[model samples]
Structure formats: structure tokens, C-alpha cells
Target: MKIIADLHTHTIASTHAYNTILEMVHYAAQAGLKAIALTDHGRRMPGAPGDWYFQNLATVPRRLEGVLVLRGIEMNIIDYEGNTDLEENAKNLDWAVASIHGGLMDPNVKPTVELCTELWLKVAQNPMVRVIGHSGTPQFAYDYEKVIPEFGRQGKLVEINEHSFLVRKSSVPNCKKIAEVCKKYGVPIVVDSDAHFCTELGVYPNAERMLKEIDFPEELIVNGDENRLYEYLRKYTKVLEEE
Candidate 1:
């Protein structure tokens, strides 16, 4: 299968990431990507953009240098209850991806897995959320069985983050488990670079290899087709409007 879109990525606005918006666009074009999302870190992160950045996203064109540009944010799940730091502003963006960062989840907390999973489902069910980024990361041990079906029912995409696999080796088994649950539930998965620099944008060969190794269904991966993604985005936009 041929995948053309990378839906999870960061820009200079994210403190730890390295690259400007223009640089990201240029690299994505060079990489032959049809579309990409600018999912910079949420406000809770040290170098994340301010409220003004999200509010003025309209200034950035929907397409840049022959590639579709999706204005988005990777919001932090602020609590086990699934409340996000930028919940109020999420509605305005083209796409909003909810994720678990260091501050939002306490690994030592009792019932960490159960609570985190419950919260993930809550966030997935929220009308404003289009995707759940890096749900497989071991640091936040969400209940895969419950979360996968919840995402399927809500038409939300579960991300298979490329960087997470290399950066968090301990989470490999958890990621495989999540993928298995998604397959059983018929939930679609989105493979993303989760790249923080121009060099990393649109790089999904590692994820592709992993999925192939597991004999994953091509139909469940959204990055394989641009038209399908446009349809998905339309539904996502509708959800945002309703919110």
C-alpha cells in the first residue's frame, strides 16, 4: 500500500522540536507527501505556542507548496479524567490530537493503567478529538481492549507513532497489543512520524515495516490514501462545528 500523509508532527513552536513551519512544509514536499499536520505540543509543554497561535491558524493556507497542510495541535491530557489543557480552544483547529505527556500522567499512581485507559476513552469520545496520538507508549498504560473499541465506535483514529517505537523500546509489546486490539475492533490506525524536525517529517518506513511484520491490514491504515483522509477530515470538521 502507498501512504501519503503524515498526520502527527511538531514545529519550532514546540520547545523540543526543531524546525519552522516553512521548513516543515519544504521537507514534506521534498519527501513526496500529499498532506501533513502541524501538531505542535500543547500549551502545557514548555515551548508550546500560546493561545494566539491556535487562534490565528487561519493565516496559514490549507495547502502549501503542493502539499495539504492541516492546522492542528497535540493537546495534553491534563488528568486521568481525560480533561485536556486546551479543550476550549481545540474546536477551532482543523485537527486535534489528544496525547499523554509527562505531566498529565503519574506512573506511580495506583490504578495508573485503569485510570489512564478510562481517561483515554473519554478523550476519544469527545467530539473535538480526531486522533489519539501514541496511545501505545508504556509510560501511560491505557487499557487497550476497552480503548480500541471506543475509538472504533467514535470513528477516531489511533496513532502508530514511529518515534515512540524507537524512543520507548519498553513499549513495543504494548504497541503490538494495541494494534492487535485495533484489528479485532476494526478500528482504523494512523501511522505518523511524530517528527520534531524537517528530517523526520513524513518518515514512516519504520512504522510500515512494523505493520508489515505483523501482517496488518492495509485498509485500516489511513496514511495509505489521500482521498480517504479528506473524507475523514470532513467528518472531523463537522464534529468540530457541532462542538
Candidate 2:
């Protein structure tokens, strides 16, 4: 399946990430992608951009270098209760990806299957969440059978993050299992670069191989087709409202 849009990525504003927003968008355009989401890290992440950075995202044009730019934030999930470090001006953004990052969670809230499952269930119900970003980390594994369906029911796209293969190697096996469970439940998903640098933008060889090995259905991947992605954004996000 061809992913016409990459729905998760990072820029220099995220500190550890190495590219600027325009650089990332330019790479997407050159890669022939129809769209890309510039999702910088949330405030709680060490060195993450200030609140003004997200609030001022309105100044970014909806389209850049012929590629649709989704103004988004990767809000860190901070507790077992599914609370996120969501900015107060979240309404100003076009997309939000809820993720559990190491070291950002509450110290008292341990990672148990039940707790993680509950966390994801609550995240699924959050109106601000569009993507359930990279939930297959071994430390934060949830009940795939229960939560995958709930994610679909809530219109949240489960992510198959390519970056995990590089940085979170131990999670790869679980990620494949998660994808298999998603396929079994007919849960729609998105494959993202989760790119921290310009060169990583729109790159998905590892993700594609895994999905193909599982014989994943093309239609169930929301960003696999340009129209399918546009349809989703129109329904769940205001990004297309002015287009």
C-alpha cells in the first residue's frame, strides 16, 4: 500500500528533532507525498517548544510547497488516567497525536496491562485526539483486543511508527502483533515516519515490509490513499475546511 500522507513527524522546535518545519515539508513534497503533519513534541517533553509555539501554528499555511501541512502536536500522556499535556489552545491546531513517552508519566502510575488499557480507552474518547501514536512500546503494551476496537469506534487512527524500529528495537515484535490484531479487528491505522530529521520524512520501508508480511488490507490504512486521507481529515479535522 502507498502512504500518500505521513501523519506524524517532528521538527527542530522539538529540540532533539533535527529539521525545521519547512525542511520537513519540502522533503515531503519532493517525496511525492500529498500531505504531512508537523507534529512537534508537547511541553512536558524535555526541551519541547513553549505553548506559544503551538498556539502560533495558525501562521503556518495550510499548504506548503504543494504538500498539505497539518498543524499538529504530539501530546504526551502523563498518567494512567490518560491525562495529556494538551495545550490550552489545542483548538487552534488541526491535529493531535496522543502518545505515552518514557520519563513523562507519573511516577506512581506503574505500567500494567490493565492500567495501559484503561489509559488508551480514555484517550480514545478524547475529542482532541486524532491519532493514537506508537502505543506498541513493550513497557506500555495494552490489551490489543479491547482497545483496538475502541480506537476504531472513536475514529482514532492507530499508528505504525517507523521510528520505533530504529530507536525502540525491543518493541518491534509487539508492534507487529499490534498490527496483526488491528488487521483481525478491521481497525484502521496510519503508518508514519515519526521522523526526527528531514531525511526520515515520508520514508516507510520497514513499516511497508511488516504490513505486507501480514497481508494487511490496503483500504484499512487511512493514509495509504490520498482521497482516503482527505476524507478522514474532512470528517475529523478542520484542516480541510478552508481548502
Candidate 3:
């Protein structure tokens, strides 16, 4: 499938990210992407945008350089209870990506993979979470069987982050497992560059290769079509409004 929308990206507003919204838009357009989401790091991260920044996202154009722009957050899962640091602002965004950011998740002395998986399952079940980003990271290990099936039932997407696979060596094996489980459960998967700069946007050839290697079905990749993406965005926006 030809993936056209990259739903996980970061802007300069996210501490370590190096791009601006305008720069991302330009790069996405040049790369022929139909849409992109600006999912800055959670408020807990140093130098992350403040509440006002997210609340004022309306000022940003929905369409920039002929590409749809989605305002979102990569919220940190702060506790085993599945609480996120940006709970108050989460419901107001265009999309929400609930993730385990290492520092935020409290293992509570257990620190077992099963315990972490259980916590993530709780986060996935939350209506506010639209996507579970970078689940393949060993640092925040989770059972794909339990998580993927439930995520599918809840209409949430599971991410195959390119950067995670590139930076975290252990992510390769886990990502393969994630793909297999997602396929088995008929869960939709989103491949993202997890790009922090404009030049990196929509650059997922490596991820595409991995998906192909796993023999993952094309239809399961959510970013494969623009029409479906717009439809999902509409539904997602409605959910945010009701929150």
C-alpha cells in the first residue's frame, strides 16, 4: 500500500525535535504526503510546549502546502494506572498518542514485562488514546497479543516507529512481533518516521521494507490512503469534541 499520512512527528516545541510547523509542512508536501500530525512530546518533557500552546493550536492552518495538518500530542503515561501528564489538554487535541516515555511510567518495584504490558493495556483501553506509539521499545515492553487485539476492538492504531527501530537495537525483534500480532488480530498499524525534523518527515522506506518482510497486509496500514485518513481524522476530531 502507498502510505500517505504520517501521524507521528515532532516540532521544535518538543525539546529535542528540530523542525517548525511550517518547515514540516513544506517537507511533507515535497515528499507527496497527504497529511502529517504534529505530535509534540508531553508536558512532562523538558522544553515541551505549555498548555496554552496546545490550546491555541487552532491558529495553525488545517491545510498547509496542500497537506492536512493534525494537531496532536505524544502524551507520557505517568503511572501504572494509565494516567497521562497531559490529561487536561488531551481531549482538546486533534489526536492523542499515549506512550511509555521511560521516565514517566512507574514500575512500582515489579518492573516486569507483564506488569508493563498490563499498564499499557489500560492506557490502550482509554477512549482518549487514538494511537499507541513505539510499543516495540524494550524499555517499555508489552505483550502484543493482549494489547493489539484490545486496541483493534477500541479502534486505536498501533505504531511501528522507524526511529525506534533505528535507535533501539532490540526494537527490531519486538517490532516484528508487533507486526505479527497486529496481523493476527486484524489490528491496523501506523508506520511513522517519528521524525524530529522536516527533512525526516515521510521517510519510512525502512519501515515499509520491514512490513513487507513480515508479509503484513497492505490494508492494515492506516496511512496507506488519504480518504481513509480523512475519515479517521473526522471521527477522531468528533471524539475529542465530546471529551
Candidate 4:
């Protein structure tokens, strides 16, 4: 199976991520990817771009260097109630990937499976969320049986993030389990680079390997075919009308 689109990535605007938006897009084009999402970090992360940054994303061309560019955010889910750093003014973003991060949850508050499961159920109902990004961090494991089906019902693509393998190795085991559960429930999924640098754009060897090992069904992966991805964007996101 091939991933024609990579719907989660970071740029220099995220503060710690190393590449510029154009650099990442260029790499996506070079890698021969049909589409890519430039999802910088949302507010709440220290030094993350302000609301103005996301609000001004309309200025970015819908297509860049022959690659479809999705102007979006990897929004940090801030509480057990599933609140995120997404500002009202930034709601027009073409795509969104909700994620759990350090600053959002209190360090002393243990990440119990029950609490995390509750959190994600709320996220699944959010209209602004199109993808559930990298949610299998060992600390933030959720109740897969209950949530995976809801994710499918809500059209939220569960992400298999490549960066987790290299930077957050602890997530690997749960990621496989999540993929397995997603398959079991016929939940749609996306494989993303979650790339912090230009060189990593469109790279998904680790994520691909996990799915191949599980003999994951190609049709369930949103990015497995260009038309499948385009069909998803048309139904669930505000992308694809870009000229």
C-alpha cells in the first residue's frame, strides 16, 4: 500500500521543528507525494505560534509545488474534558489533528486508561477534528474497543505516526495494538510522518511496516490511494477546492 498523502507534519513555526513550510512542501513534492498537511503546533505549547499565525493560514496556496498543501494544526488537547488549544478564529483551517501533549495534562495527574478514554470520546464528537494524532503514547493509552468505532463514525482518522518510532519508542507497542484494534473495528486510519524536519516529509517506513506486519487492509488507510484521500478530504475537511 502507498501513502499518497501525509496529513501530519510540523514546520519552523512550531518553534522547535526545524524546517520552513516551503521546505517541507518541497520535500513532499520531491518525494513524489500527491498531498501534504503543514500542521504546525497549536497554541498552549510554549513559544508556539499565536492565533494570528493560524488565522492567517489562508494566505498559503492550496497547492504548492504540485503537492496539495493542507493548512492545519496539530492541536494540543488540554484537559481530561478534551478541550484543545484551537482558537475560534482559527476554526477555518483546512485540517486538524488533535493530540495529547505535556503541557496540557498535569504531571501529577496520572493518565489512567479510563480518563484518557473519556477524553477521546469527547474529541471524537468535535467537528473541527479530522484526525486523532499519535494517541497511543504509553502514558495516554485509551480504551480502544469503545473509542475506535466512534472514531470511524465521526470520520476521524486514527494516525500511525512515524516519528513515534524514533523519538518516542515507548509508543510502538501500543501503536501496533491501536492499529490492530482499528482494523478489528474497520476504523479508518492515516499514516503520517509527523515530521519535524524537511528530510522526514512523506517518510513512513516504520508506520508502513507496522501495518504491513498486521496485514492491514489497504482500503481502510486514507492515504493508501490518492483518490481515497481526496474522497476523505471532500467529505470530512475543507481542503481540495484549492487551485
Candidate 3 lDDT (Cα, 0 to 1): 0.82
lDDT of 2 by residue, 1-243 (tens): 678998899999999999888889898999989999989999999999989999999899999999999999999998989999987876678899999997988777679999999999999999999999988899998999999999999999999999998888888999899999989999999999999988887889989999999999999999999888988998998888875
The reply for model 4, stretches above 4 Å from the true place, is none
Clashing pairs in 3: none
Model 3 residue 147 lDDT score? 73
Clashes of each: 0, 0, 0, 0
Q: Against the true structure, what is every candidate's RMSD?
A: 2.6, 0.9, 2.4, 1.0
Higher-ranked by lDDT: 1 or 4: 4
lDDT of 4 by residue, 41-88 (tens): 888888799999999999999988999989899999999999998999
**TM-score of model 4 relative to the true fold?**
0.97
TM-score of 3: 0.93
lDDT of each: 0.82, 0.91, 0.82, 0.90
Model 3 segments beyond 4 Å from truth? 107-110, 239-243
Q: Write the per-residue lDDT of candidate 3 for residues 158-184, one digit (tens) a residue.
A: 998888767766888888889899998
Per-residue C-alpha lDDT of model 1 across residues 176-239, encoded as one tens digit per residue: 7888888888899998888988898777776778788788898888788877787787765742
The candidate, 2 or 3, that scores higher on TM-score is 2
TM-score of 1: 0.93
Q: Which residue ranges in model 1 land beyond 4 Å of their true spot?
A: 106-108, 238-243
